[model samples]
Target: MFKTKWFSGGFSGGFSGKLSGKLSGKLSGKLSGKLSGAALAGLLTAAGAAQAASVSFVQPTDGATVSNPVHVVFALDGMKVAPAGTMMDGTGHHHLLVDGKPLAKGEVIPANDKSLHFGKGQTETDLTLPPGDHTLTLQFGDGAHRSYGPELSKTITVHVK
Candidate 1:
C-alpha cells in the first residue's frame, strides 16, 4: 500500500482469476449468437492495452529499512525511457522524492532532498537521508520536468534505520 499527498483516495481496484489444469472447459452452455475465439481474444487485448503507461521504483520497496547513502532506481512500464540529451513525446526522465511534498504540475523537480531530477535518463542514484521513516516516490516527467500524470508516479515508504 502507498500513501500520497497528491492523491485523495487510496489504491482500491483489483481483479483476480483462477485457472485449473484443464485442456478445455465449457465456456458457453447456451448461446443465441455465435462468438469467435479470436473476437474474445481481441477484446481482452484491447482492455490490457488501455491500462496506459506508469512509473515505479525499481529499488527500495515500501517499508524498507536501510542505512544512509541509499541507492535509488526507477522503473517504467508501458512507456520508453527517453535517451540522454534527447526529449520527445512519450518519454522523459525520472525524479526522486525524499519526504517530499507535492509540487505543482509542470514544475521542474529540483536536485535536492525534496525534489530530485534525472533528466539524463539516469534511473539510479545514491542518497543520504536522516535515520528515520521517510516517504519515497518516483515521478516521471517530460523534457521540462512536468509530471506525466499521477498515474505515472510511484510512491513508497522507507525507513532509514
Candidate 2:
C-alpha cells in the first residue's frame, strides 16, 4: 500500500523531511504504474502544483524540433540552487529526467542512462539524443538527491531531427 500526504484538501500536514524515502517509495511505485492519466491528473490538481517551487525548461519549447546536442537550460522558481549535500531548506539541484516522468515526492532519484544529475548545481547542459520524440522532465531534488515531488517538476516533449 502507498502512503500519501497531499498538499490540499485531501491530505495531511507535516510531511517532514523524515518521511522522504519511505513515502516516495510507497506512493510513486503505485501511482506511476496503476493510475490512469485522468486519475493522476485529478490527484495532481488536488495536490496544487502552483503552491510549490517549480522547475522548468527554459529552452526547447514543447513540440519543437531540434538537432542533436540539444541545449537544455533549466529554470527554478521559489528556491535556490545548491550543490548536492547542502541539505538546506528551499535549495536543491537540477535533474534532467530524459525520456521519463517526474519521480515521486521525496524519492531518491536513481542514477542511470535516462536520469542526469547536476550535483554541481548546473543550470544548463547540452544533451545528445537519437532522432525521435523524447520527453524531458525537469525535476528538483534536495541536497540528498531526494525529489521535491510532482508539484515541483515540469515535463516537456521535443523532437530531435
Candidate 3:
C-alpha cells in the first residue's frame, strides 16, 4: 500500500500496489507527455489566441524616466502566478525579458542575466541598468518554463536618469 497527497485538484486517496503503475503512468502522462513538440506548440499558440491573459509593469510607466536600480513590478490577469514546476492549469510564473523579444511558442525561457526567470513566482524586482533608455518586458511562462509568447507579455520603455 502507498499513501498519496494531492493538491490544486480534487483528488485524494490511498491505493495499494496493484494501482501504482497505472496511476504513475496516468500522472506522468498528464504532467509531461500529454502534449509535446509540434503538438505542444500548436496548443500553446491556440491557448494564446483563445485566452486574454496579460502581464504588465506596475512601477515604471512606459516612456518614463527613472534613476538607476529600477524597481520593476509585475501584474497579471486572467491567470494565477504559481511557482515553477507546479503544473496546475491556468497558473504560471514570470520572466523578465530585458530588451528582448518573447520566446517562441513551446520554447523554454532561458535562465540568464538577460532573460531573467522568476521561477519562485516573484512579482517584483530591482534591476541596475546602464544609464540609457531600455525596454523591460514581463513575460509569463508555464510550469515547465515554456513561453506563453507575446500574448502574455508586456513591454515598457524607460530612460535612466
* Top candidate (lDDT): 2
Candidate 3 structure quality by residue, lDDT tens digits, 1-161? 11112123221111111224664466457857666443543454454432356778878999999886677777786567888898966678888878888777678998776788777777777787878888888888999999888898888999988
Provide the TM-score for each candidate, comma-separated: 0.63, 0.68, 0.68
- Where does model 2 exceed 4 Å of error? 1-51
Please give, for residues 56-97, the per-residue lDDT of candidate 2 as tens digits.
Answer: 778989998998778887777656787789886667888888
lDDT of 1 by residue, 1-161 (tens): 22212212211112122223231133343321455543433333454523366777767888788876776766776555663355655567777777775455676667654787665567677787777788887887777777776666778998887
Rank order (by TM-score, best first): 2, 3, 1
150, model 2: CA deviation in Å? 0.3
Off by over 4 Å in 3: 1-51
The deviation in Å at residue 64 for candidate 1 is 0.8
Give the higher-TM-score candidate: 1 or 2.
Answer: 2
Please give the CA lDDT of all the candidate structures.
0.61, 0.73, 0.70
**How many residue pairs clash in model 3?**
0
Specify the poorest-scoring 10-residue window by lDDT in model 3: 9-18
**Models sorted by lDDT, best on top:** 2, 3, 1
Q: Distance (Å) between predicted and true CA of 113, model 3?
A: 0.9
Query: Who is ahead in lDDT, 2 or 3?
Result: 2
After superposition, the stretches of candidate 1 with alpha carbons farther than 4 Å from their true spots are 1-50, 83-85, 102-104
